[model samples]
Target: MDIRPTDRPDRRTFAIISHPDAGKTTLTEKLLLFGGAIRAAGEVKARGAARRARSDWMKIEQQRGISVTSSVMTFERDGLTFNLLDTPGHEDFSEDTYRTLTAVDSAVMVIDAARGIEAQTRKLFEVCRMRSVPIITFVNKVDREGREPFALLDEIADQLALDVSPMNWPIGMGGQFEGLYDLEHDRLMRPAADNARGFEGDVEQLGGMDDAKLATLISSQGLALLREEAELAQAGYAPFDDTAYRHGDLTPVYFGSALKDFGVAELIDALARFAPSPRPQPADPAPISPDDANVTGFIFKVQANMNPMHRDRVAFMRLCSGKFRRGMKLNQMGTGKAIAVHSPILFFAREREVADEAFPGDIIGIPNHGTLRVGDTLTDGPPVTITGLPNFAPEILRRVALKDPTKTKQLRKALDDLAEEGIIQVFYPSIGGQWIVGVVGQLQLEVLISRLEVEYKVDAVLEPSPWDTARWISAATPEELKAFTDLHRGALAEDRDGAPVFMARDTWELGYVSDRNRAIRFSATKERN
Candidate 1:
């Protein structure tokens, strides 16, 4: 098949990542505002009758003012379709964020100017680096008192091990905040004081280094400081190199206050001009190219009951190549069965519209009916699996049961659907087949219970399990697997996907099992083939 350059230049897919309360959601809203996706940008925390952030549509998220699940939003700007994957900032939901990252081509790292690099930010950055995904840094909350611009850049370079290229320089920080200097265009952007959350600003063309108007706007002292820093940044910092960025070696940094809507347009403009389009995705047997004739994609997320009015499930699929029509037939890689996609929906937060056709880098929602699961690949060609979706070992274990015995079927279906979404890992003991759930944290358990009661109308109770750790077992041969299972018959259980798992009561028990069974390998994570 012949593939040509510029075949998918109009597409751009990226994710927004940050630590909790670092203004990640705010930044997302402002970007949507610039793209004309929303008429008025809403605050993350709004009072009575005020609209909340469109990206945060879930009831829990709206009430808590925090994102617990990743949201996919798409917008069109300058003839380019941009898919923005807004990830959860809470550390408790990092697993979901990690999965979301796997589906994006690039990432936008939002940093708090005052706090600098944070724990969650570092973890997310490491994942990005591992994938070699290009990153764009936005030093947020410059409108408030925060770190010095140079110091923030230094921190990013020293901590993240990324070469920093300052695309624009901040005029003044905190209360004295004036605006920004456009380095490439040699222009001064003076944001209107009353333009908070609106897309209106003033620009002044800087003729030379010694402009009198610059001194007047920022005061003489501030101008001197700006000039000194600007000269130093130009001479010392690395220039923005597209090659380095594509390889994840360098990052272009922009300073802005997302809350006030200042300096947002500049960042969006840069993404439109330089960010990469949909690229080839790695799949089993062979990599899938964007210009491939057959339709191909993967389900990275499965959300159940997005709308309370209708108990519906939507599988979020990222189109890696080819065009996806509303009623196209494709092979489910997991099941090896051809299925027709009848409802391919596009999303603007929770609001969705049926999409007639979609291209590479677009995320379309497929109405699911117990057939889809996270990490399942779909294609019109031969069955090809995209690996690297991880099933992390759960830390918290609970033996859960339905409050009403008559609703057994309802409880089973609810648990299965939630487990399929990766919200929690459900396990069945070998002896009685009792349901035991394994989760990364207690918050996940809470969310699962809340969802069951609210969405599924099933009441459940969780009792503490004695196990502290769980591991998946792998053997070289059938005999070895049988022998291992026979020896530890009582400890064996099956995960939600029916994979064998061994639960240990404590570290000592785990060590004893390892010493006793020398042939079996215990793994903390499971990789799909």
Candidate 2:
């Protein structure tokens, strides 16, 4: 509860991750609404979809109705500062989501009650599990017809391999829907009017589930079924374990319909109570603790043009140590230059306001021209590079063909900016004037084209590249690398950072080439050295 530079604050920095069409956007809207960051749900700039998540700010995301960019939002409730990171739900953006997960303390996994533990959900869960990031499951769409609560919980336990504990149980699901029984608080929450999407409007105070007044609201059959299921869920699943949950061994599940806003309030409270403050971050030489008496933060993401009017670039820095005051020059470890951040920002209603000061577990955007980069660490004390941030190998590769020759400079500028955002990779061939572009997924290409048309006013088409995939080439000595590059000059290219890369037609060819050159290493991932 202390607000000093050395004292730790009540911070809950977490992300919401789910598969596509799992009511992820709706849940985000309600969380912001309950946190009082937004005045109304309708306050989000609505386009054709009408209810897209405000975090889906990019034009391509709105058009495709799938979140591809990670959006960071900061808010507070009950004197606890909450940094809610909305990660990309689509599988194409899994790489971005993976990096975003590194910045959070925990994650809320949203599952469709009717369709439990989806493919994308499972993948994201594994990433969380790998880092020991705690998870809280929300079974969404309970108001609609869906699977039984017990079956859903079992599926999660089996698929995720984590102990399942029910924080709240649904009375009846789908058409038979009644409401949720607060297992922890021992109360009843009935459904609201048809127009309202949540259950906060009508709640009944009760001593416990066995209170005599329960018979007034429920039919005998429904009551019996509710009691039977609730009892089994409690007895069968693992009991709530904060220590296990934080260590990623157990998950506390809650049932609700984000569309109906059923259990969002409880979810927020769970985060405030159970979710952790800033934890020690992995770094070279040593790990950085939250209580360290130094300003330390890493740039996990960079946005090229968040505002169309200003056409500015903002580096999203997760405050990992010390309290940050505006105008303080922190050393950018990437270039050994001091960056005096004048306007650090927080997100709300799609607007930016200068952050005068920020503490650990807070995400503030530092606006800069181009001095900062993704994976760069800034600190006021001894410099240490943050670890685990890396660029992935692109699955889809192509050559850019400018539709108008006069716009060559514009296309180059556009590619550079988008590349810095980490959505795409630019490769300059050693022997040709044509530039190659690569991305982890196809949607990233669409986003690049859309941003170019809207933001940079350039037109281009993607043509098939000679290579199917590429790898970063490294050798024990410069002579070995040069000999390989000189022999395969036609297949050699340079990445955005000017790292040598060997382009291959396919995985089979890549293997053949690597086998032939025993001294060269073709790596799929390019990590910071």
Candidate 3:
């Protein structure tokens, strides 16, 4: 068997998403441990001596114990390259997670067993459903007392409106938590001891439902319940359908306790076996194939400063097809100019290293300087634009000012870079000069301010703006756009990308503008042009 990264069949690129405090980060760490990417799993909230999660590399995340940005982690296990995108679970950072989802072929949804489906998880799931991205569900934190497995499954089915297939069944719960029974293979996996870590404490595997030891691990009543549920699940309550799963209609659910490191390996193994590889990406002329000979990829995310000391910018590109080699010349689809990729960087959270070559389904970062923007595609073949990246309207509007007037250039540069990363939207008044920053939530504004001070050594302040919502304006021709801009000059602005936007004080004002300017179209969400 050929074991190379270019072997597309062995590649698995997926994102892990969940609500805040759903143990998503913990699950990511355990997956890394099983993949041998890290020596030991790091706790999300380390007490006295334990270390923090490796994926949550930002200082703000460590202090707050919440992921504020998405991190890409690549690890090779069992001759497969698993590009795992660990996304922020906080609602404030949902935009970042949404963008990350566009780059993967599948998604692993981590749901809290006690909480079931959460607001943030549902929002992320909707995005996955929109893209037809296959989803694998993992109910985390089953070690503690929580909702019944059947109830949780039903809740997911009803709320998310998707078929739920139980791949494995939990033996017991809370204090009596023993292990899980694999429904696919009909085997019982019992942990040797409680609170085992890093695949420690030999896992006792019992084959055959009639095994005598099964009665000893689980009570007679508990055993009866497991048998009944397994039978119902296997009989047809939730049968695994590959076509349905690939079409985002079915989700294979697994029960696990990420904190104790149980069931993590099984989940990883299932992903390797079933997760889709780099699929055809939607592009301008048509969808691009991963098997295409020409190298192609798109910039889904951009980070202003990964290393606070260097003051650098990185444009994260997901290789869609063919192979990428350092120093190869590729055309920037946005500009239609040939550019050489000098330093192709690969990431493991905050840490990074230069890579010589990469293949489809792999994510490689290129050190950029105002050259790369989000949604910009690069290819060795014909120029084509990758579609489906949505830019949501900002909910909070504010006017920003730099404390030091002499650092105006630095401040403007910093804001431009941050805006490119989608942290905030920088808008300029129709009359020009003054800049306004708009964000989906307050946390985004906070992150922008923090990054300016930490990365660019510039202090900034934001004053609240009366406008509550923003929309990009589109028209049939340039004349119509100018006419509408002139008509609504006071409410008109230009986004960082130079797209015309209308700032409305309220929904009524927005409606008035739409009613007044019938020629112009107001879009709350705009896709990459």
Local distance difference test scores for all models: 0.85, 0.87, 0.85
Could you tell me the lDDT of residue 466 within candidate 1? 64
Can you rank all candidates by TM-score, best first? Answer: 2, 1, 3
What tens digits encode model 3's per-residue C-alpha lDDT throughout 1-529?
6444444887899999999999998899989878877767763322344344489877677878888999998888999999999998988888889999999999999999889998999999999998999999999887788888889999999999999999898866776666788877766666655345222544456775667887987679878878787777677656888989999999999998888877788899989988998899999998998888889999999997788777788999999988889999999986788889989998888777799999999999999787888888999997788998888898889988878889999988988988889888888888656688988877888788877887788998988676778999999999999888887798888887789999999999999889988999999898865
What TM-score does each of the candidates earn?
0.95, 0.96, 0.94
Candidate 3 at 237: error in angstroms? 1.9
Q: Model 1: per-residue lDDT, tens digit, 299-342? A: 99999888888879999998988878889998998788888999
Give per-candidate clash totals.
0, 3, 0
Model 3 — TM-score against the truth? 0.94
Task: Compare the candidates by lDDT and give the number of the best one.
Answer: 2
Candidate 3 clashes: the total is 0
Candidate 3 lDDT (Cα, 0 to 1)? 0.85
Q: In TM-score terms, which candidate is top?
A: 2
Model 1 spans > 4 angstroms off: 1-6, 43-53, 193-199
